[model samples]
Target: MRRKHLLNTFAAAALRIFMLLTLGVMMTLETKADISEEYPDFYTGAEGTNTKGINFVQSITVLAPEYCSSVMGDFTVVFKAPGMKYIKAFCWRQPTDKNPGKWGHDAVLADMELKEGEMGKFVVKGDEFPNGPMTIRIHAKDDKNKQDICELQLYNLGGVKWNQGIPDRDPPGAAGMARVFADDFDGPLSISPDGMNARYAAHKTGGGDFSGWQFSDPHGENQPFAQRDTFLRIHASKPLGTQGRSGILSSLRPDGTGVAVSIPSYFECRFVAQSAPGTWPAFWTLTKNTIGMDKNDPTFEKISKMGSDELDIVEAYGGYGHKNPNSGGVYSSVSHFWGQPKPDWNQRKLADGSENTDFKPSSFRTDTLQLGGKSSWSWTFHTYGLAITETDTIYYFDDIEIGRHPTGEVSKALPAWFLINYSIGGISGWQIDMERYGNKTDMWVDFVRVYSGCVQAPEVSASGFPGAKPAVVTMSASTRGAEIRYTLDGSEPSEKSTLYTSPVSVSQPCTIKVRGFGKNLKPSPVTEYILTTPPGVQGSIGINFVTDMADSEQALAPGDVTGIAPYIQGNWNNVLAGTKTTSRFSTSDGATSPVTLNIEGEAKPEKGEPWGFSGNDRRLKRGNLVSNPRFTLAGIPYAKYDVVVILGAGIHNVQGEIHLAEAESGNHIDAFSFDYGWNGGQHAIATTKPGEAAKNTNYIVFRNVTQKDITITMKWGSGKGWTGVAAIQIVPQKD
Candidate 1:
């Protein structure tokens, strides 16, 4: 029974082991199959197609690419949409380093719709991303529903990268800097045989070069054609002569059928003398009619009608120490206006202190300063330029503005062709170098650049309080050819704004907006100003007074008393008075009685004839009391006031003096004083006080009065002056 049981158990155990082995084998095969289906070998469209029918489904991936590190050129993505008239595709990118499957918001690529039955490929160019792993997603819409798909990998193969679809590298040989205009001339111009050829070659080569045009006697053999007034004269020796000529081999003359190029309204012309003992070279513009024609020709009427203007862009006289004559420097730029005769051009003083009074009709002269130690006349290639506009004319030299002339009154007849020449020998009439006659000196021409039109000034605005009549404002601008226009309304101004005939009027407060338009009709920034009306006032008055010697005593009174009795009794010395007594007298019925005192003595006049005592008692004798009393009333408003003064009239020398004080206690205010003789009179001197009410009740006083004067009289005494007494007072109106 035991043996049979053992056999069964063994059989059961074997069966279990076999079952376990089978299950293990199945699990291993399942895991291998799952990994193989989930992850396939990475391939980019650039490498080749993975499977034809099982399209890469670019719509299922990011817009750009993944693994674009090796991407070069453009990849054509082909896809199809069924039953749709039109289809559109958009591309996006996902970085493999972070959020490998998630796309970013910035669209790296996009494309318009593709027509039905049209099989198009979207190009995935290189440089879309830098060397890195990226996932490209594409969305395709076919009318109704949208289908999204993707590609696994793409790359930049040409060492280029793209971040957000922008190239990662700059183009080869790009320095990332701006180019500057060539303004400095340091080398010699490359010259050729022919004059025109030399100028053209120098311009092409772009340095400093010379054309074989001389400004000496053109009739001489081996010399170019002598074109009078058209050619510039270049001299190697000092003190340029009045008469210098040169030859210009140009078949075209200013009067001929040559093309008329408009002169710029603004430009700079600069010339440099290359030699240290520099030759003064002058570039002048002359009317064609002035050339080879007598000064008194009948046809000159037609010729003179062709007005010509010249600008002395620069002039360097050899006598001016090898430098420019005008500025006493190496470079000088000046402008000339010659439409009509003017003092600036025809009457200018030369370096020799002589005036150039003879009008050369249509001639403009400029020069180049000296440089280095050579005697060469080196011209700035394009240093000087001219501009002509409908409104004005401007000249420039070496990029610096020389001058400007308004064309408001002048006609706009364009100038003919220009000439460049150098002069050698001439008569010593204007002091030419006789020894250096016929010296070979060259005037180099680099290039001539002509521009047209004028630069206008900026615009300005007049803004202030609204509705206030008489509102004033000032407008300013910076420009060469602009006029100011303004409007009072808040509305913007067009060409129709009120033209600023003059400064704006501010009778009423208003907001005025202003704008400036250039010759090109372009408006500038608006400038603004605010204006307001002033306030007003009511009435006016003035005051005047006189002081005598007795008045001085009243002024020196000890206290602020209005009456003068106490001063006479206490200060008067026995030398001026034999006795002193008071009498009752009154100008008005007041609580106090008015009293007059009498004093007598030998009062003498000092040398300046009608002499009176110096009101400064401390500086005079007892018999001749030096009493001149002057007072400044403080805190007084200018108004009218009643004034009263009394003087004692008797037989002693007495004269009165009075003066008005300014608002402040100084000599800054004006003063007026008068002398009076003591003849019996009602008040010796009195008038309504001027300049408001006296804040400090102060008055001028006199010294030598000795008697009572109910009747006041003033007289001039040839002998000892008379005596006077009493008081002065002022009262305000009750109103």
Candidate 2:
């Protein structure tokens, strides 16, 4: 085992080395091509060093594809430069004499000051540019007046596909959930009055920020938020007065009025971390009454007396090497319950025996859970989710369970609104060394989504097959307190549609559509069913065979004996070994047939079949385990009937085998193999199966069963060597 482990480790190391080499080759080739075609003679300056040590701008490289088919969401830019004053991005569709290189001041998308050797990361919104191929140039300049520029082309599709490859991060017990709020940042950022007409508010309405930086426009006059490649870019740049200018988007407005979800809900965000030192990016939530409107609102009283809650779903601290150990690879999810009576940081307890006002932990319900990821948070995108249930608060990273804690008392009592922010060094003790990153950084968010329980689509079931006669169809929805509305004339079902009180009798051929609606819940998806009658067929012809020990009262068979397609019911008629009995079966259509069943082997059948087996448990799914049943049928009336044999026991994983052949001709007809545990092959009842217009699993139909006399042999396939023959069906096909 040790030798095998060593071999596996060596193989993994070799594979990683090979991948790195391949990536290096690809990047080298891409850089060469970009420099050769896109860069003009002046853009590619000589490597003669004048002031800065290396003159790194001559071969400036943007760590991305030179030509992107669809640029939606924020993309990272990594360049090599030993010293530079600033690096900026500009975009234009076509170059003209007025702006020959499309590098006009109007085309400037983002400009940031970078320290020596620090890369310039900016958010480029695709919609800000045109739809066709657009030229984007990244320009960098040193204090020595020496500068370098590189250009790349990108195609904008104008839409964000954020849902692609995103994992479903629904928490346990969060079933029957519906999306309540979603923001993909696919278009221009909308900043309305208190976020009333917009998805996000530019700044905090009540104005109490924990970070050293204030929430303002990082780009001076413009809003700090930008939509890039279907992502929200929050820029954090140079300081203003005592604090720096950063970006933050709050769901709550200035009046403390905004969208907020209650307890037992889920909130999630997919984002790429900034990871630059002194930068702090967070996706967190606060109680509705957290920051009231200047002590005038009644919510202010609640904050003073009852206190508020802060659920930090993710608080990512940036700093590669700093006093604080946290970096791009580690993040924390904390639940902070503020102390009551005019909440303040002084109320928090210090780590020492005595409490200190500065740099101390607050709230008795302070549960901070730190999680690590395989790669740096800024390297790629990752989803951070929080499931707030009645009893527990669960946190997830990339849909995988990370840490969980008990629900805070205050959090359970109040509704919460979310906030996404890019903060600069403040309360967090991490060093603010922006010199490495040129003093500017960015936080990118792919999307933010929240979900709660809502109305669910109704499951439709039919009593009989669609034909000349009426079929009673029942509609049932899973969501509690939801009302089901349906339409029979094929029109879309709405709240005004006919309320489903009882079973709907669908006569002739028609379409049935249903939808569920409830108070404070999103309506369910419209479920449609096209009911059609078979051509030239008054009714169907079928037969069902069960063991003698099985309950005869159960409606396990697909078609009823008295339905449009009458099916004959039969039993195995268990007797002594070598027993031969001729059972005459009668159909609802008055079709009588003589089926001579000659059992030559031992008939080992289980005792007393359970009732209600076919209703919820699916009849024939679990049944008696029998052995060695060789039955020969001489008289089959139909010239062409689909013979379906149910093999395997649902309760066990035993394999069962069945082979059928012409009795007189001794020619092979067909064979089937199944394992009860796997539920292999066709295993569903055709008529009652949902979305099964015709065929079903476990409904193996032998089309060319022309001969009347056929022999069926059943035995165990493999595994435990114990299998059961629950039932069989024969449906007549069209001539």
Q: How high is each candidate's TM-score?
A: 0.24, 0.39
Quote the positional error of residue 29 for candidate 1 in Å: 99
Best candidate, TM-score: 2
CA deviation > 4 Å runs, candidate 2: 1-173, 217-222, 239-243, 290-303, 322-328, 340-373, 454-735
How far out, in Å, is residue 116 in model 1?
99
- Model 1, C-alpha of 528: deviation from truth (Å): 52
lDDT of 1 at 202: 10
Q: What is the lDDT of candidate 2?
A: 0.53
Candidate 1 least-lDDT 10 residues: 535-544
- C-alpha RMSD of candidate 1: 42.1
RMSD versus native structure for model 2: 26.7
lDDT of 2 by residue, 636-705 (tens): 7767766655543334445555677898876878765554443332244323222222321233345547
